[model samples]
Target: MSTSTAGRPYALIAEFETPASTLHAAELIRDAGYKRWDVHTPFPIHGLDGAMGLRNSKVGWFTFLGGTTGFSLGMLMIWWMGKVDYAIPVGGKPLFSPIFAFPVSYELTILLGAFGTLFGMFFLNRLPRHYHPLLKHPRFRNVTHDRIYVVIECADPKFSDAETRKLLEHAGGRHIEIVED
Candidate 1:
């Protein structure tokens, strides 16, 4: 395994030939007390998230909060404009009508909810990442074609170069590379 001049590892990446092998490797890694690990595959593999011990995403909460905020603001705007700010009496109608405010509130809710979902995904996923350590590996180039990769970062407390390589090999991984930072 390669290491930096300061004796710090960069990352350990393992290559698998099939999605099933990758899934098995992820499960092994998850159970091995390593926290900083990730899997990459050409296509989505069933049960991979569970194997990786990942929980549901938080983007839905962001969307719900944003929609609620938009709804509240829309209602406040309509009520204030119609009743307190400029109570323009139009054809003997009620100043603060729920029927009239419903459309604006609904539209604003949808708009803000969509924006929240989009931005939430971007933020949660750490988008706009210009470079990644895996991107520098030559075998990683086949990830988009028909390869699966499981990478364990050196930052994990349980990360030991010898043990990690052995674990990956036991989990049916091949072409293991000690990626450099």
Candidate 2:
């Protein structure tokens, strides 16, 4: 609402009346070979990721690595503690049997996998962000309510003010505006 163009340009955003239109715009942006873009909706939209041409997240890899490390560490710790450091054999059972270590290793795998998921999410999302240019946009708050938005950052290599606006307009976007930082 301040209509002041004095601030540095950050992004170009457009409002869509419905999720379907928003999805269409996202597809157009994606096919245009633009990176550094995002869509905002009041709630999750099915197939939006595919529309935006996104690949699967890498968080699962982190979880697998963490779980593997945890299991290996748990098994090694149990084996070293029982078999080498202080051998404790009872009832003719082996000192470092995997059967005995299975429970703790499984628990450790679960614990560390959970941790990996948490940390991976934080890392991928760039969490703890206190500010963004969009956060200051007057229209952006509507995305938390009934509105949907598609934003293309100025930093995107394919971004051009006129052509991007044309694409959004052709894709049924309305009230297209430049967001500033």
Top-lDDT structure, candidate number:
2
Candidate 2 lDDT by residue in tens digits, 1-181: 2244558898889889877788888888898999889998889899999999989999998899889988998999999999999988899989988998999999999889889988988999898677777888887888899999889988899999999999989999989999987
- TM-score of every model? 0.89, 0.89
Model 2 C-alpha lDDT versus the unseen true structure: 0.88
What is residue 64's positional error in candidate 1, in angstroms?
Answer: 1.0
RMSD of each: 3.3, 3.8
Error of 2 at 88 (Å): 3.3
